[model samples]
Target: MEFSPRTAIVTGSDSGIGRATAVALAEAGMDVGITWHSDRAGAEHTAEQVRAAGRKAAIRQLDTTVIPGCAAVIDELAEELGGLDVFVNNAGAGDGVGFLELDHTIWARTMDINLNGAFACIQAAARRMVAAGNGGRIIAVTSVHETQPKVHAAAYVSAKHGLGGLIKTIALELAPHGITANSVAPGAISTPMSGQDGDDPEPTLYPGIPLGRSGRATEIAAVIAFLALPASSYVTGASWAADGGMLQMGPVGSAHLDSSNWRQG
Candidate 1:
């Protein structure tokens, strides 16, 4: 419940949602472990932000696509931080190839990073939590495509859908151990991934989103921080849609459209 001095590991924390979540957890009085795949500088910057918040920061280079090594980093970071109370599986990759052009290699690569890697890290983190005899929190940063289909992102959509199910299963299995697993689904966030930069920009009004704009990384992080609290103990196996009400419309919102132009690049 009280997260003061608790430690958390956030995978792919060099930027985007992971970075925001790490900083937020630090601000909430938890020491944080930050991992990066390519951007060591970004990871260091994130660590700096965490330290600036007056929390301990551990930095590591983690390529989630690596098998045993991916999970091993979780253990290493936990040991370095003394222990772990929270794990955020935020590392993922995707491509825009159409389903018809989707090959086995691309599909495998996407699954390897987005689904398999996440599973490895979650297993490692949960094992540590159980072994320590302390309840913990497991959060995954999924996407709106987890529930909705996109035009040319078959691999990404499939992986996110699998991740959603995986979190639910983990929640069920870990409940007895006082560990909770859940996911935060973001949509059109203003991050580098979505081709946005700098401060949280004003969202452009869109017909599909009730909120009329994209979301901010900090907005999603706020939800993750809440889920990590002792107050959210009962909120396991849930997928919180932080998508500005985008999912609320689904196909019905666009079914009446007369043009295929919406799918154009």
Candidate 2:
């Protein structure tokens, strides 16, 4: 519980929520290791922001589907940063194909990126934390789909759900080492993954969300940053939903539905 983290690593920090989280952790006085999949420039941008916040920033290329190689990237970054006190598993992707049309290749890729890769990478980080004998924090960036089902996103939903469960199991297994594991589930956010710029989510009017708008990447970052801090030491094995009340729409949506057309999605 007495945590003074000096270094942190965030996967998929090249953009969106990952980028925001790296910056937030840096602002919290922790050196940050940032990883990118395809966008080296975006990763560099995040590093710059980290440096601007007066924290050391290390950049690495991470392809989560690359199995042991991706796990190696996490270790490499931790080494470069001197040590790892916080690890955020934020690298993930979703295939929007319907279940009827989903293929094994796509399903496997989704599982590898969002679940399998996370398992490997988080395990690697946890090993370092255990060996260092420093109480650490492990946070996963899951989605609201981790709890709710999406119409055309069976693979994605399942993978997020798996990641969420993995965090809970980790919380139980790592507690003896003083390592707390948790997850943050976000609703529709304005990010590249959501086909919108990762800027202002306030102007985007979304009637489905109770807040009447999409969420900003920074909003979710704030929650993740809190989990990585000593203030959250007592919290573990928990999933925090940063959605704009989107998860609470099931009953409301059903009550207001004009017809059965909603079943098509």
Candidate 3:
């Protein structure tokens, strides 16, 4: 677990789970590279937190949907931080369009960010690690939807399922190079993406979350940090769900009721 002076990159780190992960990595004694798609201020704030933790912080602008160029940001940050030791593919977009209403444009956008972007970035990082002759960690921030499906999020579900498969493949390919690949699948986390401005969850969101509340971004980050550790070398090709027992509920929960209400709003 001695990550002292190691370098890590976290995408979509301007806020939410990404921000928490960047800071957590810093606190664990690793220099962190933080990227934001649109929120420069939030990225800066995350940098400040990293600096305060006595670790170096590098910030960059990355739009995962930008194709091959988007993945180059990892190289840039690695150069700035001296080298790459960990890469967290946390940048993703969610879709809520029903299956019948989904369009090619929406599906493409979702796949471009959540799947294509991650593939490119992982390739870039793994190349560096392999060339450097040092093992590295590759963690993707998938969701419970990676396994369980939602009523109206066809695109997102498909992209995450693909991501899960990609991570497993990477785990097999990279293990020979001494690198490890895994995923952290979160449930309802109280981030801006989940419609909460703060760490606390709304009462209405409690019904589906088995812990009776939404999770905090830091909760998910802690798991990511564990997977990043050198001691986790044997844990590749696994999806660690940080969900509040929601995934375990499965068909037994109230969510299984024969109701089309989930598709209405």
Candidate 4:
């Protein structure tokens, strides 16, 4: 089916990758619904950019950790936007607690925010798309850890892995509905989450990454924008890694590890 997306909802659009994606979709001629977890001002800023691109923009405060109730925001936004053609689950959280130090609270919070919340929101969006009888796109912004394990991030890795698997299953179940589900697993990015404060990633040396630097949020946004387009109709259930070859560095990284400090993390 051909996709002519006119409206999109991106959770966590207050800043970083989500903000970039909202703007990209707007630039592609779609009205955007932007949500923020804690930064209403930031979300408004993103909305301003969308409006500047000559598209309608809607703003809402969304806390994914709120579960089934939080999913209502999707419906509200879809209604406000006239309809929903694209849904991007970019709201997630992570911590540096190792497996041994990981507690139930932290674990559950991480799961609630990253995996459980994603399930609810994506399901809500899919239901709307199915009811509208319009094919749609569902994209999740997972991490490279979705496919690889990382030190000091057991919960994060687990959540991302679960979210990735959920997308694959959704792809199978929703294929007949003309909805495509996919995940974008990004590597180290220069966002506030990475302590970079949205700086240019070019000069920042990401020693182990093959690209020699961290990825820019806009770079990941481009990949997501492509997946949202009709050009990606043939693509689904795929996890596109926008990482600068970070996943490919496993063997190569091991070969270059000159000290035991790598395990200390």
Candidate 5:
């Protein structure tokens, strides 16, 4: 437990990375609010895990795209937890469509959830924190695509890219208020959504990946927990990469050379 008596709202926290983040915060001794759009059972399960960590938990329905009274939702959660301290903007979705095949609707929907939703959620959380006159942490979960361009994911890539910029801006704006904002961009993580058999997410993510493996949700969560820690009070407006040396290398080249094929193992 790193931050006790603190309240954190992790949106879309029913499963996968979001669920893991919520649990991580709970284990850090913070009371957590679990928001789910469609996974009530999963949300309750997460709450149970939080409670098991000896902290209070709250579950709420937060469709960030709607942006209807989202701050009110956070206010309620903060009241329940006794105060607001940290907020994780982990809710998002992607279209998985390439630039050419991507429809306007797909782009709009992707932006609405991935980019716009995060913006709204951050604003709502910040408003409550400022109102309560308490400094807090706001961590956004971006993707490797935030900087790397991925094929067949134009909308997703663009939205993720914008998310990083948004976090930077928020960090600058909120610094005067003693609130910190940062982003965590994770590489291919072994999640059910990535369909990696709960083992290796990307044995072949790309030859450029020096680590030669996809990351895990827990791995990413650990970095997030670092930013959320009170010790990181001096850190803000930074984008931390958890891509396993992917960024240290060159681009993901598609051209495989035949001369590279060796007969010997």
Candidate 6:
């Protein structure tokens, strides 16, 4: 119960990592505000779990992609929570498109939803924390694309790389306020985004991932929970990769392998 009596707002709490994170926080004794963009049922289910854990829970509709008014929503939500102490911006999407084949519309929407929306949420949350004049935690759920790039995932890779850089920048700006900002970059998490086998999604994608398997949503949630804990006070502007050691796999095989056969980057 590191954050007992504290309030946390988790975006996209209906399912996946977000739902798991809400439950994890509740289990640690924090009041949780769960938001879902499209899954009201899942949100209610998470709320029930929160209550079952003996913690206060609330549900709300949140679309991080909607700007301007998102700031109002943050203010109102803070009021509802009776004051905010932590924020986890876990709502994001992935876009698969080749750079040349991607249309401007797809590119623009991808940037808006994945990067801009998160930027707005962080800004709103930081504003509230600054006003409160107390230390707080801000976490962003990014992807392995935070440092590695996927060939056909131009928009997603670009946005994730940008979001990670944005976290570093925001950390510098917020550190003076006693607020810490960090990102959890998960590699191949087995979420609805990757487990889908329809034509729209490439199910077998990234089989080359050295992890040899995709990660579960709860696995990623546990990492986020660690960052939200009070014990992580000294950490800021750091991105902890939760990718099962996949990111360490170089193109020429492991660094332990013979890279003498390859040219330098």
Best by lDDT: 2
Each model's TM-score, in the order given? 0.95, 0.97, 0.94, 0.97, 0.88, 0.87
Q: In model 2, which regions exceed 4 Å deviation?
A: 198-203, 259-265
Q: Candidate 4: where is the Cα deviation over 4 Å?
A: 199-203
- Tens digit of per-residue lDDT, candidate 3, span 83-145: 999999999989888899999999999999899988998899999988987788999999999
TM-score of 2: 0.97
Model 3 TM-score relative to the real fold: 0.94
- Kindly list the per-residue Cα lDDT of model 5 for residues 121-205, writing each as its tens digit: 7888898877877688999999888998877788899999999999999899988788899999988677756775332244435
For model 6, what is the C-alpha lDDT against the true structure? 0.80
> Which ten residues in a row are the worst by lDDT in model 5?
256-265
Per-residue accuracy of model 6 over 1-265 as CA lDDT, tens digit each: 1232388888888887888899888887788988888879888988998899998888888776677666676677778878788899888886767777889888888887788888887798898888988778899999888898777788988999999999899899988888888999987776666664221232234545666676777788888888888888889999999987787787534446545542221
lDDT-better candidate, 3 vs 4:
4
The candidate 1 region of ten consecutive residues with least summed lDDT is 197-206
What lDDT, from 0 to 1, does candidate 1 have?
0.88
Worst 10 residues of 2 by lDDT: 195-204
Per-residue CA lDDT of candidate 2, range 1-265, in tens?
A: 4789999999999999999999999999999999999999999999999999999999999888889797789889999999999999999998888899999999999999999999999999999999999899999999999999988899999999999999999899999999999999999888888887643344468887899988899999999999999999899999999999999999987798788875566
TM-score of 4: 0.97
lDDT of each: 0.88, 0.93, 0.88, 0.91, 0.81, 0.80
In model 3, the clashing pairs are none
Question: Once model 3 is optimally superposed onto the true structure by TM-score, how far is the C-alpha of residue 109 displaced, in angstroms?
Answer: 0.7
Off by over 4 Å in 3: 1-5, 198-205, 255-259
Candidate 5 segments whose C-alpha is farther than 4 A from its true place: 1-5, 196-208, 251-265
